[model samples]
Target: MFLEKLASKGVTLAQLPIPVVRNEVERLVLSYAQQRQWFLWQMEPDGSAYNIPTALRFRGQLDLAALQRSFETLIQRHEALRTTIGEEDGQLLQVIHPCQPFELARQAVGTLDEGALQAQVALEVQQPFDLARGPLLRVKLLDLAQEEHVLVLTLHHIVADGWSMPLLIDELVSLYEGYSQGREVALAELPIQYADYAIWQRAWMDAGERERQLAYWMSQLGDDHPVLELPTDRPRPAQQSYRGQRINVDLGEALGLSLKQLVQRQGATAFMLLLASFQVLLHRYSGQADVRVGVPIANRNRVETERLIGFFVNTQVMRAAFDTQLTFSELLAQVRQRALAAQVHQDLPFEQLVDALQPERSLSHSPLFQVMYNHQTRVKGERRSLPGLEVESLPWRVHAAQFDLTLDTFEHEHGFSATLTFATDLFDAATIQQMATHWRNLLQGIVANPDQRVAELPLMDDTDRQHIVDGWNATQADYPGDTSIHQLIEAQVFATPDAPALVFGEHTLTYAQLNRRANQLAHKLREQGVGPDVLVGIAMERSLEMVIGLLGIVKAGGTYVPLDPEYPQDRLSYMFEDSGIPLLLTQSHLRETLPIPAGLRSLDLDGENLEGYSDANPNIDVAPLNLAYVIYTSGSTGRPKGAGNSHQALVNRLWWMQKAYGLDASDSVLQKTPFSFDVSVWEFFWPLMTGARLV
Candidate 1:
C-alpha cells in the first residue's frame, strides 16, 4: 500500500537524493574492512578463500574490442579495482596503482561442453592474486561457440563485495551498450573514489560515532558467545577447512507467497520472519536455548559509499534466546525487535566488535557465530540488459566456505531460490539436503499455523516421522516374557553357581554366595515392613555392600533409590523430602554425613544382625510391572527431577543388551559408574544376569 501510494504520487526510489563522497585528496590508510582482509591474507598467504568471482554469458555476436574498452573505462573510474594492500612502517595500508592498459585473458574453447567449461571456470576462480604485486582483479573471456561468449570477473575481497558485483556489472554493460553503437555516452563519474571514503570513514568514526554504536553492541552481546553445535556428520577439524560447495534449493511459489503474506500481517519484513524460522530450526537441531547467527549487512547506509566499488559490507551478529513454548508469532516479535535494534547499531564494524569483545580465539571455528544467513532480492539482474545480446548469469562453484554453514537465498520471479553452502569437512551433501528440506518444511508449518508453539512446529514430513518412530526401531527380537529382574538373576545363579557375581577390592562373591547373602537381607527387610511398592533409599559410596543393599531391597519387592554420599547435605535433604522414602540403608561410617530426615527407620547393612535370617532364596511375589528404581537427573535447571522406571522396561533393556553384545562367562563387565545413573543399572545387572563377571 505504501508502494502504491508512492506510485500514485509519481515517486520512485531512483528519484531520491543519493549523495556521493567527492574529495580532491585520497588517504593511504586502509578501511577497517580492508585491514581485516589483510590480516587473514597474511595468515594464509596462498589461500584463495577470500576470492570473489562472478560470471555472465552472452548468446549473441559480441564486439570484443568494445567490451574491452568498456572494462578499461570502468576499472579506471573506480580506484578500488586497482588498489592493493601493503605495509608502511609496520602498519597495513592500501596503495592505489596507476591506470594501465587493460588485458582481458581470452580462452577459445568452442569445442568444450558445459561441464568442461565450468571446470575451467573453477580453475580460474581458484587462482591466487598477489596483493603486494598489484592487479587484484582478473577478467577472462571464454569463446564458447560461434555466436556465444562467457565473461568471468574475479576480484579479491579486499577490493569488492556482493554489493559491488551488480554495480560493476551494470556500469560495464552500460559502457558497452554505448561504445558498440559508436556513441560516446558514459556513466556519471563518481564524485570520489573508495580511498577518499576510507579516509572519511576514519574521520567519521573518530567523532564519537564508533563509541556510540559500540555501546549498543556491547550491551546487546554482553559476555555471551554461543558456539553453534549443530550435529554434523563428522567432528570439526582443528583448523577451518575452507573447502565447500553449494546445492540449490527451491521453496515453491505458493509457499513463498504465503510466507510473505504472513510476514506482512505481522508487520515484519521477510528477513525477520525467515530469520525467526531459521532460529527455530537451529534450536531444534541443537536443542539449544540460545542461537547466534551472523548476517552480512550491506553497511552502505551512507549514500556516499553506495555506488563506490569497495568492500563496504560488514557483518552483524544477530543474537537471541528461544524457548520451546514460544509461539511462531511471539518468536517473530522478538526477532523483529532485535532486527530493528541491530539495524540501528549496524555501523559498528564487526572487526571492531571482535577486537573489543576479545572472545576466546580458536582457529577451528569462527568467533561469536559460525553460521550465517543471507537474503537477497535479485531485481538488479532482471533490470540489467546488454545491447543486442541475451545475458544469463553463469554459476561458478564455491571452493571455500566463510562459515560452518551459510544459507544464501535470493528472491527472483520464480518466488525463492536458495542455496546452502557448507564446509565440506564437517557435513555431507545429504545432511545439508535434509536441512534444506527441514527449513522449508518449518516455514510451511509456521505459515500454516502462526499461533502454534515453535517447538510443536513440523520439521519433518510423515515419511521422516515414520522412519524415526518405526523404521529405525525395528528391533523385534523374542525374549523371555513375564520375568522379573531378580528372576533373571536367579536363573543365572542356578546356571553358574561358582561364577563371580560381585567383586570389590580383593573380595569376590560367586553367584551362589552373593544370592545367599542377598536372600538373608531380603528376609530381614521383609520382617522390617519392606514389601511390594515400598520406597527405600541406599546412601553409600561405590562398594560391594552398596550393590548388596540395592539388590537385597529389590529382592524384598521394594524400590530402591541410590543416593551418592558425596552430594551436599542440602541436595540430600531435598532428595529425601522429594522421594518420601520410609527406610534408609547406609553404613555406620557414613551416618555422620548423611542428611537423615526425622522418623526415618535406618539400618546399617554391615552392622545389622541378620545371622538368624534364612540363607535360602526368599519366595517373594515380585511382578514385572512393579517399580524398579528411581533415578534423579540434575538437568539444565538447578532442580533434580526423579523419573521412575518399571521392572518390565529394565528387563527388556537388559535382554536387548544381552542379545546385542552377547556377554558370557569370559566377559568381565566393569561397574564404575555411580548407582544413581541408568547406565549403572545395566552395568550392575546385565552382567550378573548373564553369568558375566562384575568387576
Candidate 2:
C-alpha cells in the first residue's frame, strides 16, 4: 500500500549496486567475522558449539527429487555454502570451490516415535562441521512414511547466522514449489556472491573506513568492559561452557500491541525500547549503574549482501547508566541516542573492537559483555506454504550457550514472545525462569507508566514477591523482644541453675556460681559510679574473669567497651579516646606495659578484693534500649572507630542464632574468636541463652 502511494508520487525505491569484485578468486581473504569463527573452531575442534540447524516436518505428498534439487540450487547460488576455510602464511583464507552437484542424504526409519525423531534432529545438530573440509552446509531427510518427511538443514555459523536462516527457508519454499510444479526456477540472479561482498568489505575498510568506525566505537565503549555480575545458582567454571537451556515467555497479544504503541509514542524503534527494558532488568538484578549488553546487528545495510547467505552479523555493545532518579522515559531517550550512534558506526568488526579495546581476557566469559539481547522480526519456520504439503516447524534447539545469557525476543502478528537462553553451568533452570518473568514484568511496568523512575518499575508480580519476602523469610520464632541481653542469661540461670555455663582450660563455672560471681563484680562496679550511658573499657585476655567483667559492667547499667589486649599501644590509645572510657578493667600483670591515658582509672580484676560484696544479682534498672557494648574496628584506614549496639539488638541477634541453629543444652559452642570480632558475640551469648554451654 505504501509502495503504491510512492509509485503514484513518482518516487521509486532504488537499490544502487555495490561495486562488484572483478575476477578476484586467487587470494580470497575471509571476512573478519569468518576469521573469528575459524579461531573458535581451532579452540574447540570437536565441539558443535557453532552449528546452526533448522528442521521442519512436511506431511503431504512429498517430492523427493524437487527437495534434493532445492538443496543443490541453494548451495550453487551461495558460494559460501560450498566453501571451506584454510590457513596459509598465518592467515585464515576462504577457499571457494566451483559449483558442484550436491546430494541430500536420506534416512529411512519405519514409524519412528516423536522422541526418536527429535533425537535424530539433535544428532545432526551436534555433529561438528569440519571447516577445513569442503561442504560447510549439510542436509538430511528422514522418511517416516510414504507421505511424511522431515528435513534437517545444518550450517556452520562461519557461513551463516540468525539472519541467513530465513533467507534459506524462503528460497527453499519458492524453489521447491516451482520445481514440484515443473515450472522454471523464477528466483532473480544475484548481483554478487558472498565472496564478492567479503572482498568488497575488506577494500571498504582499508580506505580509512576502519579508523573512522574504530574511533566511534572506542569513544563509545572505551577500554573499560565491566563484567556484569549476575547472581548465579552455582559457582562459575574456570572455563566457558557451551551447555545451556532455554525457556519461552508468552507476553500475550495485548502486551505485544502495548509495546508497539509505546514504541511509537517514544519516537524510538522497537529494538531501542526492548533494549532499554533489558538494561533496566539487568540493572535491577545486578544493582549496577553501568550496564553493558551486546546486541547483534545484521550488518546488511548494503543491498548487495541482503539476499546472500553468510555470516555478516556484527555485535555492538549498548552501555547505559542507570540510577534511581532516572525515569523510564528518560532512559528511552538515552537509549535512542546511543542506539542511533551505534547503528551509524555499527560496521566496525567486533573482533577488531575486541583487539583494540583489549578488555581483560577471560576464559569464563565473553569479552566486552556477558549478556546478549536480540529482537527477531522473522518468525521461525515462517515461509510460503507450498502447493501439496502442510509444513509444520520442528524446533531444533542447539542447546548451546554462546554467552552467559541471551534474551531473544520475537515479534509476532498479534503478540510478542521471548526465549531466554542461559548457561546451565552458572544458572539453574528455575533462576532463569524467574528472570524471564521479571523481564516481562519490567516491560509491562514500562508500558503502563513511562514517566515513572526505572528503578521503581516492577520486576516481579505479587506471587513472586510473596515467595521472596514472606515464604523465604518464614524464620519467625517467639523470643523476649523487649528484654535486655543479660536478662536472658538470668532467666536461663533460673531455669537450670546447676548447669555448666562457662568452661575454660582446667576451670569451670556452673550457672549458679557464674551468676553469683558476676553479682559480686557488679556491686563493685556500682560503687565506681558506673551507670546507664557510661562506657567502661574491658581490656583482658579470654578467660573466665573476662566473662565476669563484661557481665558485671552490663549488670551495673553501663556499656562495656571491648579493648583487645593484643592491639598495639597506639591503637589502644585511640580506642580509649574514641570510646571515652573513664574506667579500664585489666589484669595487674599488664598495668606497667599498657598505655594508660592520664587521669584514666585502671582496675586490676585479678588483684581486686571482693570478699565483702554481696553475691546477688544487682538491682540496677537497664532497659532494652540502653547501650549494651561498644566494639572498636581494626581501622585499617587510620584510627580505630567504635560501633555501639543496643541491648535489644544484641538480644535479637542471640535469639535468632538459637532459633536458626537449634542449639540445645547438649551442644557446646567454642568461643575461640576474640571479643572484638562481632561473631564472638553470638558465639558467647547464643549458647548461654539457649541452655547450651559456651566454651
Candidate 3:
C-alpha cells in the first residue's frame, strides 16, 4: 500500500534508471550500506524520509521573497537538484523527476532573540533522514530575527564527499545572483555526469588495465615488511581504531622557500626535501636506519575522472634507507627518483595490495605502512555569500581512518601548514609535540644550508643534545660501584636470597632458588658433554625455568639459543638442528611439542629428578668474552640469520646504560618488551647489573 501511494505521487520503479557500475562506485555503495548498518541509521526504506546536505549561515536583513526566488532558480539550473532515486528491479536507481520549483516553509517565532532563532534552526537541521529511501537530501532556513537568517543544507554521503561540496557551493552562488537579477544564467554544460564517469571507469579497469598497475605495486613493495620500532610506554592493542587528535605545525614562508630552493637545486620537488627531513627525523628518534611511510596519491589520472566526483584515492608504501654520510642534495635526488617511481606505480588499492603481499593478517597493524603522508596542493576558492548576508563556515563533524599517524600538508598563502593527526590511544600528546619541534628544527637546518652533508645537518641543538646525554649519564653517589655483571648478580643473590628475581607465567623464583636451579641445569648440561663454544637450545615457554635455563647455560660456559616455543615445530627443529645443539633444556609442558633431533640430549626442568637438585647452587666461573646468546632476526631469504653476541657485548650494553641513566638500586625499570625483541636485553640485564630494581 505504501508503494502504491508513492507511485501515485510520481515516485515509481519505472521512473528511475540504475546507475553505472565501477569498482570504486560499487565499493562506495557497499560501504554506505555497511556504515548505515553499523553506525548512523534512523530511517526506513520509504521514499518520504530523506537526508539533505546543507550549508548553514546567518544572513542579516535578507529579503524573504528574494531568497525563495533564488532557491527556485538554483534548482532549475542544476539537474542534480531535481534528480531523485526510486526502486527498479529491486535496486535503487536515480531518476530525473519533474518538480514544482523549490518549496519554502516559514514558521513565525514569538521572540526575536538570536539564541531562539539558532535553537530552531538547529532542531530542523538535526532531523534525521532515512538514506535507504529515495529522498536523501534536505535544506532548511530559520529566521532568528527580521534581518538574521540561518541556512542549513544536509545530504547523504552517497551523493558527495569533501571534494563535491565546493562545487555545489560555487554553482549555488552563481545561480543565486542570476535569479536575483532576473537574467538568463549562462553556465557551461558539463561534459558528462558522474554516472558516465563510473561507466567509463568500469570499462577501463576491465581491459586488463588494473592487472598491469598491480604488478608494478608488487615489485616496488618487495616481500620485507619492516616494522617501525618506536618504543611504546604501554602494551599495544590487538587492533588500532580511528580515535585521534590533530597537532598543526606551521612552516613560515622563509623556511618553506628555502626548502623549495634546496630541492630545486637538486632537480627535485619540495616533497623530496620533506621526505628526506622526515627520514632523518625517524632515524634520530627511533635509532633505525630504515623507515617506511604511507603516501596517499590522488589516483585521478584519467582526464574524465578529474571533474568526476568520487573516491579515487590510493596509497603507496614508500621505504627510505638513510646513510648518515650522504649530502642533503644527494639524499633529495634519491628521494625524488623513489617518489617518482612510487607515483608511477600508485594504481593498486591499499587494501588489495596488503591482502596480496601479506598472507598473515593477524598482525596488529597493516604490514605495508602504519604512518601516512598526504600532500594536498588543491584548494577551493573562497565562497561568496548571497546578497545582504554575511556567511561563516565551520566543520561540524568529520570521520578519519585507523592509522598510527597521518600528516596532512596544505599550501597556504604564506607557506605550508602540516596538520599531524595521531592516535591518542597509542601516543601521548607530549610525544607528538616533541615530534613537531623536531621536524621544525630539521627542516630549518636543511633550509639554512642545503649544500651541507646530512651528517652535518644540525639534528638537535647542542643544549638539547647535552640534556639528553645528561639524562643518560649514570654518575651518581647512589650508583653501584664498577663491578662485573656476574659479580653484581652474585651480590644481589647473597644480599636478598629470598627476594623474587624472575617471574614468568604462573611461576616466580627467588634469587637463591633461581641461582640453585640454574646451577643444577648447568651441571646437567656439563654431564651431557656441553661446555664452552657449545650452543644449548632453550626450547620452552616464557617461564621461570626459561630464565633459569638461560643463566645456567651461560654460567656453565655455553651459549644459549632461545628457541621460541611459539615457533612452528618444523622451524624450531630446523634452528636446533642447524645450530648443532647437543643439549636442550625445556619444561615438561613443551616437551611433547618439540622434535627431539638425533644426538640431542633433553633435560626437562619440570621433571621429578631435577626438583631435588633445584636448591644446589654450583658457583661456576665464566669469562665476559665467552658467547652469551645468539638471536635470529628476519632476513631477505625468508630464513632467520643468527646474530651471535658474547658476554662482553652484554656487559658493554649494561655499562652503557649504567653510565647513561645513573642507575641505582632505588630506581625501578619496567620489563615490558618480549624476550624475542632486542629491547629485552637492555630492559632485563641493565637493572640487574646496576642493582636497580626491575619492575
Candidate 4:
C-alpha cells in the first residue's frame, strides 16, 4: 500500500482499532432509517440527501503519483476514510479496515469544459455509497487539457460534515506537498479517533448530563409548537418529499459595510446581525411571536477535537420571541443571548433532543423547526498554494434540503452572499426570489435604522411600495367635476330623461319622473328650512317612498339621517336624539308609532299634501363638500353614535364603485340592508349614482 511504502521510508502512521464505537450522532442517524437496509447504512441515494461531496480544482498539476500517494496517506492517517458502519448484535458499529490500496478514477478530457466537469460532479455526488462494503469515499481525477486537473472527493455524511471539509483539505495539502518534494511530512498524531469521541458522548449523556440539557431545551421550546406559516405557491403535501431548489442573493458592498458597522456598535458579530434580521423577516412573514430556527454549530469545543476530522457538527435550535413593541436593538440583544445559550448547550445531538422534547410528530413537517440558518466564513486568504499546482475550491450541489427552507450565508473577502434553498414542492421560483429581495431590503433597513422596531422597519423599497399602493389602486376616471350627489343625479336626469332610475318591485320611475317627484318633496322640505347644516330624520321602511324621501332631503341641500323603523323604540329614540334632527319623514302607517321626539315634527310621505307644492327643483346652493347623510350605529352600548359623510366623499366612493364593478343602467343592485347601518347609505345611493336600478 502507498501508506506502507511511506512507512518503509521511516514515516510513522497511526493505526485505528479493528471495531470501534459508533458516535451518538451515528447511532441517531441509524434510527432515522425506515428499513433495515437504511439501518445498516445502505442508503438509497435517490430518495435521500445524505451524501457530502466536495470538489477541488488544481491547475498545473504534473505529478499524478504524488497526488495519489497523498490521498492514500490521508486515508491511512484518518480512520474515518477507511471506516464503514454495520450492524452487530442489534447495535450499529463502525468497522475500520487496517489498510487498502489507494486508487483514483482518472478521466482525460481533450478540451476543458467547465460545464461538463460540473455535470460529472453532480452525477458523482448523487451516487449511493455502500456502508457495509469498502470505499465509503471516492476520489475522481479529471485531466482537462494538459495542466488543468480537478480532484473531486465525495464522502458519505456519516463520516463527514461541513466543518470536516476544511480539515480534510488542509491535511491533504500538507501530505501532498511532502510527497511532491520528497521531504518528510511531520503531522501531529490525533489524540483520539472519532470512535472514542462517540463513546465518550454516549457515556456522558447517559450520566445525569442529558436530563439537565433536556430540561433546558424543554423549557426553551414550550408546549405550543406552531409551524411557520410561510406563504407558499402550493399547499403542503401529505408527506415531505425533500425536493428543493435554491435562489442566490448578495449583500451589496454599501449595506454590507453598514451591517458590519452596526454589528460593531452592538458589540456583536456579523452572524448575530444576520440571524436577528432573519428572525425579524420570518416574524414579519409568518406573524408568529415565537420563532425557532435550527442553526448548525461546529461542535469542536475541546482542543483535541478541534484538529480531528469527523462528523463533529451539531444543530442547535435558536429560538427568539419577537414583539412588535420591541426595538430592533432590543431584539438583537435577545437573539444574542439565545444564540450564546444554544452554543453552550450544543452537546445534545439534534436527534436525541427531538426524542427528549417529544414535539407533535408529523411526516409532513420537520420536527421542532422547518427553517435552517447557516453561516460559513470561508478562509480564502489562508488557502495553501501548492508547489507547482494552483488549488481552489469548486462549488458543487451535494443534495436537496433537509428542511423546508435553508438560508446559507457565506462570508467572502469582499462581502457576503446569501442563498435561500427552498423546497420546490412547497414554493415556486418567483416566490423565493421575492423573499430574497425582501431579505436584502430588511438588512438595509436594519443597518440604516437600527433603533426602529422590528414591525416598523420597511421591507419594500419605494418602487415596490408604489406597485402595491398606487399601481393596484390606479382607478381614477373623470366624473362631473364640482358636483354634489343631487347635482350629479340632476345632470343624469337631463341626459337620460326616459331611463329607468328608481325601481321597486313592479314600480319603475324614469329619470325625469323621479326628478319631478323628488322636486315636489324638496319644495316642501325647503319651506321647513331644510338647508345646509340641517339634518332630517328619514325613519322609513324599505319601499319606494323611502327612496323618494332620501332624494328629496338631498335635493333640498340637507343631509338625511337614516332611522330604521324596524329598530326597537328605545334604540330609535336614542338614534333620533343623537342625530338632533328637527324634522322626520316616514309613511303615514308608521308615523303614529315612530319614535319622534317632542320637538321633532313628522311628515308622512304617503299622506303629505304635495298637490299644491311646486314640482320644480328647489335650486338650493349646495357645495360638493356639504354633508350628504348621517348614519347612526346600533346602540350596542347605552347611546348610539352618528357618522356623517360629505357629498364629495360619497361622490368619490360612487365613482370608484362605478369603475370597479362597471355598474351601468342594466345592473340592478339589491337594497335590503337596514337604513341605520352605514352600508345602507352606499346601497341606497350607489345604484342611482351609476344609473343602475336598486332592487
Candidate 5:
C-alpha cells in the first residue's frame, strides 16, 4: 500500500534495489523485541540503556562547517546511517532512505563553562530515539571556546556496536580532511552493505551448521544456569530502572607487568587471566562455583565485513567453573580453553542460543548471566589522532545498564584503565567503589602468587582485613581458668538456690533440688568406677531425669555419651562400641533394647537400688581440659565417628554466648534438639552456666 502511494507521486519504489528478504539475525532480534513488547515503547517510550554515546574533545583550530559536511558525506557513503528499523507485514524490515541534505546539529556554547558543557552533553545522551522513524543516529558539536570544541555522537544499538565506534571516527577524520582540502576522498569502494551481509549470514547458516553450533552451547551450559543474587543497596523494583554509574580503576605498572608475565607463563591470553580474576572475585562475593559472564565478540570474521559499520557484534556466554582446589594458573588455563572455544563458535547469535537452551526467562533480570565483560585494548590507537585535531576520548557515565554490572577495560601506556559500570538502582556508588578496589587487590594478589589456590587469593587489603578480623572479633573478656562446666553450675547453684533450673511437662526442679539429684546419681556412678576418661552412655526419653543424667556424668568426672533411643538399634550398638562406654544409664524399659557390652553394667535410673545413694556433691578434682563428652556422628557419608570435646572448649563457648546475647537468670531455653547432634551440646550447657532455666 505504501508502494502504491509512492507510485502515484511519480516515485517508482520498485526501481530501487532494496531487498525485503528477512535475515536470520534480524528475524531473531525482531522476535525477541515482539515478545518483550518493546515495540509498544514506540508509542509510550522509555529512554533505554541501548544508546551508545561517544564524545571527543578537540583543542585547536576547528572547522565546524567542514566537519558538518564530512558527516553528511559519511552518511551518504553508509546506508545504515540513513536506515530505519520497523515492522512491515509483521516482520522486521530495514527501510533505506535516499541520500538527501543532512545537517549535523551544532551549538555555540562559548559562554558556558566546562562543567556546564558536560551537563549539556549528558542531557543529549539521555534523549531517546524513535527507532521506527527515518534516522536512528544523532550528532552535536558544542563550541566550548574559540579554539576548543566537543563533538558528541550518539547511536542506537540496533544499527551500531562498540567496534563501529572506532571505524566511524577514523572515516570521519578522513572525510573531514578531504572536505577541508576541497579534494575527492580516494577511499575504496564497499563490497556490500550491512543488509547484504545479514542476508548472506542467513543463507550460510544451513540446517547442519545450526545444529553443530547449538550442540556445543547446550553441552557447555548444561541444564543449570546459575543466576547471581548480588546484594543490592535498595530493593529491586518490579521493573528495571536502567540507572547506572562508572567507577574508574587502574592496575599500577608493576602489577600490570607481573600480570602480563603471569599470563605468558600460563600460556594464556590477557583476556583469560582478567576473566579468571573476575570469576574469582564473583566467587568470593557470591560463594557460587558456577560463574557466567557475557562477552561481546566482533562477529565480523570475514575481511569484507570488517570495515563496514553495522551491528555485527554477537554476545558469547563465557562460563568459568571456580574450584577451590584449582590453582589460579589452572583456572586460567580452563578459562583460556573456554574462551577459545567460544570464539570458534561465535557465529551463533546470542538470541538464538538462548532460544535453543530455553533457560528460565524473566523480565526482572537477564537470562544466563547478569554481568558483562569487554576489552577495548585493540582499538586504543584509533582514538589517538583525528587527522589534524588532537583527539582525546571523553569518559562519561551512561545513565543506564544493560546488565547488573559491566566491566570495560582499556589498555593504555602506563598500565590499564578499568571502568566498572553498574546499575545505580541495584548498587550504591560506595559498594561499586569497594568492588573496584577489590578487583584490583585480587589482581595484585594473584600476580604475586599465581601458584596459590584461587580460593586463597586475598580480596581485601590490610586495612579491610584489620577492620574485619580485629574490629569485629573484639570479644575478649575475663573468664575463670580453674573452673569446669560443673563448677560453673555449682557457682550458679550457690547464687540462686531457689531458682527453677529444669522443667518438663508438669515436673520442675529448683537449682538446689537439681544439684542434689545429680549429686546422688554422681555418687552412685562413682561407686561404679566412673571417673575422668570414663564414658557413660545415657539413653532415655526427654524428661527432667535426662538433665540429671547429663549433669551427673560431668559431676562424676566422666564423659557423657548420649544415645537417642529412637535411633535404630544398629546405630546405638555402633556408638556403644565406638566410644567403649563402661556404663549405660537408661530407664528400666529400655535396658532390653540396647546391646550391652561385655563386662559393662547397664544401670536403670528407675530401679529401687538408687534409694541408698548419697545426695551430696562429690569431691572430684576434674581439670577444665578434661573430656566432657564423646559424641558419635551419623555414618551417612562414611563410617560413624566419635568426636571428643573438652571442658575448656565447652566453657569458652558458653561464656561467649552469655556475653553475646546477655543471657541471664530470666531466660528459659528450649532443649528439644536430640543429644546426638553437636548443636545440642551448646543448648544443654548454655542455660546451666548462665543461670537460665532449661525446658
Candidate 6:
C-alpha cells in the first residue's frame, strides 16, 4: 500500500555519477570518514535487512507547475544535488552528472482536516533514509486551502547535516518565488563547490598545517590523564551502545536575571557561570579535583563559510580543576579566561587531535572527554505562511550518540532550558531524576550567594545528594548473608559442577571443567614464577579461554593485564614493557603475531594441559585486598597507562550492586560484552558471587 501511494506520486529512483578529483586523494579519504554513511542500511552483526525511504508532506493549495520548475532550477544550480558515485580507474569517486527532471505528481484530498494532515506528514517524515547508495531527497506538497500549501523536504544524512538545512531552505524559497513571478533569477554564483573545499582541505593539511595542529593538541593535553572517578554501582561497558534518556530543565526569568547579575559582578558571561556550576557538580559527584569536558565549537569563522553548508564543527576539550578553597566567582573568572584561550586555538578537528595525541583508547570509555556541554542562541526570523495555511516548525527528535552524557542549552523567550541526555543502559531513570534535582539545587545555591566557595555551598540542602550517599552505603540483603566471591563459589563448587558455566561460539565449559582448567593454568603460572606484585599479560581473541585465563591469574595471586589482540604490535609491546610483565598467556594460534621479549615467558592456554591436575584441589586462600586486574586507559603520551585495582574494589562494587539492584544468584545475566570492558567485569563477577547463572 505504501509503495502504491509512492508510485502514484511519481517518485522513482534515479541513477547519477558522483565525481571526484584525482589529486585530492587524501581529502577524499577524510571526507569518506566525515561523511555519514550509516543511513544506507541498518545492520547488526547478525544478518538482518531493512530499507530506508525519504518522506515528504505538503499542506494547503499548491501550484504543481511552479513547484516543479523551482525544483529543476535549484538542482541545476547546485553541483552536489546532481552528483552520484562512479568508478574511475578502479577507484570510487563522486561524478557530477545531470539527472533527468524529477517526477512530480498532484494528489487532491477532498477532506479539510488540518490535524490529520499534519499527523500524516509527521509519520512520513519519521521514516529512515539510506544515504550510502546515493542522495535520498524528496519533496512533498500539502494543500491546506485553495490558496495555501505546505512544502516538506527530506534529505539523507550522507548528503547533508543540520548546517545545510538553512542553506537549502533559503535557496528553495528564493527560486520558488522567482519562478512564480516568471522573472529572470538573480542569484550569486557559488565561488567553490563542495568538492573543491574537500580538495583544498586535504592540501592544506598535507602542507605542514596538520603537524602544527597535532603539536598544539599534544601539548594541550598533558601527562596525568586522569578519568573522572564517578562512583558507579555497576562496571562500565567495553563498546558504547545506543541506550540513552533525556531530561529538560527550565531556568525561570528570575533565576536567569540573577545568574546574569552574578556573572556581571564576576566579569564573565552566562555560559561561564553554567560551566563553573557543572564543574563543581562533577567534582562533587565524581570526587575528582580536576574535571575535563568536551565542548563543540562552530568553525564558521570565515564570512564565506557562514553560508556554505558542511560539517564545520570541531570539539574543544575544557579542563577545570577545582579546589575547595576557591570561591565560585573566582572559579567562574578562571573558566572564562580558559574558554577564551580554547576558542583562539579551535582550528584542530577532534579526529585529527586524537591521531596526533594518540591517547590510549579504552574499551570502557571514550579517549577524551565523556561529558559535553553546548549553548546555542537561536536564529530570529518571522514564520512565513501561504494563504489559508499555518505552518509551524516541529521540535527535532533526539538522536543518540556515543557519549556518556551530553547537555545542551538554548536561550528561550523568558529564560533558558538545559537538556540533559544520558545513556539509559548505564544510568537508570532514578539516577537521572536525582541528577536533575541536584542540578537545580546547585544552581539555586550559586544564585543565592555568588561569593560562596564550592565546598562551602550548602549541598546538604539537596535531597539527591543524601540519597546518593545513602544508596552507596546500603548493603544487599539477598546475598548469602555475609560471604565473599571466593566463599560463595566454594559453596556452589559441587552443586553445579557439571553445568555449563561459560559458552563462546561453538565452545562450552562446565563449572567443574572450567574450575579444573583454571587451576591447571594457575599451577602453570606459579611454575613460571608469577605471584603477588607481578603482572600477567593475557592476549587472545574474545573467547571462553580469555575469561578463564583472567580468572586463573587472579586465583594464582597475580594481577592480569588484558591485551586486546587487535591492538597494534608496537602498542602491545609498550604496555607489556611498561607494566613489567614477566609472563604472558595466549593461544598458540596467535604466537607469531605476538612475539614478546626473549626473557618474557609465554604459555599457550589453548593447547593441551601440560600439568596433570585433578578437579579436586585444596581451596586456595585469596585475600580481599589482593590485586585483581589492571585496566589500561588512554594516556597523554600516546601510550596506554594501566590502572591497578584491588580485589577489595571489585568486591565493594559487587556489594554495592547487590544493595542497589538486589541482584542475586537467581538472576540470569547474558554476558554479551567483551572482558576488556569494565562493564563486563560486573556481568562476570556479580553473578558468580551471588550464585547467579551467567547465560
> Please, what is the TM-score per model?
0.75, 0.90, 0.55, 0.68, 0.71, 0.56
lDDT of 4 at 309: 64
Q: Which ten residues in a row have the lowest lDDT in candidate 5?
A: 28-37
Name the regions of candidate 6 deviating beyond 4 angstroms.
1-59, 62-74, 80-100, 103-131, 136-158, 177-185, 223-235, 362-365, 379-382, 458-695
Q: Ranking under lDDT, best-scoring first?
A: 2, 1, 5, 4, 6, 3
lDDT of 2 by residue, 1-695 (tens): 32343355464444223444535345778888998888888888888777888888898898888988888888888887888998889877888888888777889876887788778888888888889995888888888999888888889999998889878988888889999999879687787777777766676676567899999888888767799999989888988768887888888898999999998998998889999999998999999999999999999998778888999999999999988799999999999999988888988899988989999988888899999999987676553467889777888554788888999988878767889999989999899888988988998899999999987999889998999899999977787778887788898999999999999998989988988988899899899989887999998998998998988898888999988888888888778887879899999888877788999988888989887999888868888788988887777886667888898889888777676789888999999899988777788778888888989
1-695 in candidate 1: lDDT tens per residue? 32343355575544532223323333378889888888888777777888988888888879888898998998799999988888877877788888999988998988687789889888888888888886988999988887888888889999999999888888888888889888886577576678766765665566567898989988988986879999999999998868898888889999988987887899998888888888898899999988999999998887667788999899999886877588988889998998999898887788889999998899889899999999998653453356778877887678889889998888766567788999998999999999999999999899899999988999998889899889989877777657779888989999999988888889999999989889889998999898878889999877778888888988999999888898878889999999999999999999989989889999998788888999887878877778889988875586898888878889999998888899999999998888888899999889989999999
For each candidate, the alpha-carbon lDDT, in order, equals: 0.85, 0.85, 0.62, 0.78, 0.79, 0.64
State each model's C-alpha RMSD to the native.
7.5, 5.6, 11.7, 8.1, 7.5, 16.4
Name the weakest run of 10 consecutive residues (lDDT summed) in model 1: 16-25
**Candidate with the greatest TM-score versus the true structure:** 2
Full-model lDDT, candidate 1: 0.85
Among all windows of ten consecutive residues in candidate 3, which has the lowest summed lDDT? 29-38
Better of 2 and 4 by lDDT: 2
Residue 646 alpha-carbon offset, candidate 1, angstroms? 5.3
Q: How far is candidate 2 from the true structure (C-alpha RMSD, Å)?
A: 5.6
Name the better of 1 and 4 by TM-score. Answer: 1
The per-prediction tally of clashing pairs is 0, 0, 19, 0, 0, 25
- Cα lDDT of model 4 overall? 0.78
lDDT of 4 by residue, 1-695 (tens): 32343355464333312122343234422322112234324323454466677888887866788888888888888887888767677877767788799877988865646677778777776677877785778888877768887777877777777877778888888888888998878789877777666655655566566787878888888787778888888998877777777777877877777887788899987788898889888999999998899898887887767777677788888888987699899999988887788877777777778777778887688888999999988753254578988888887543466788989898766678788988888988898888888989989888788999889888898988999899989966787546788887887788778889888879999888888989999999999989986999997788888889999999999999987778888888777777788999988888778877787787989888788988877888888788999887555774667878898888888877777788887888888778777787778888777677778
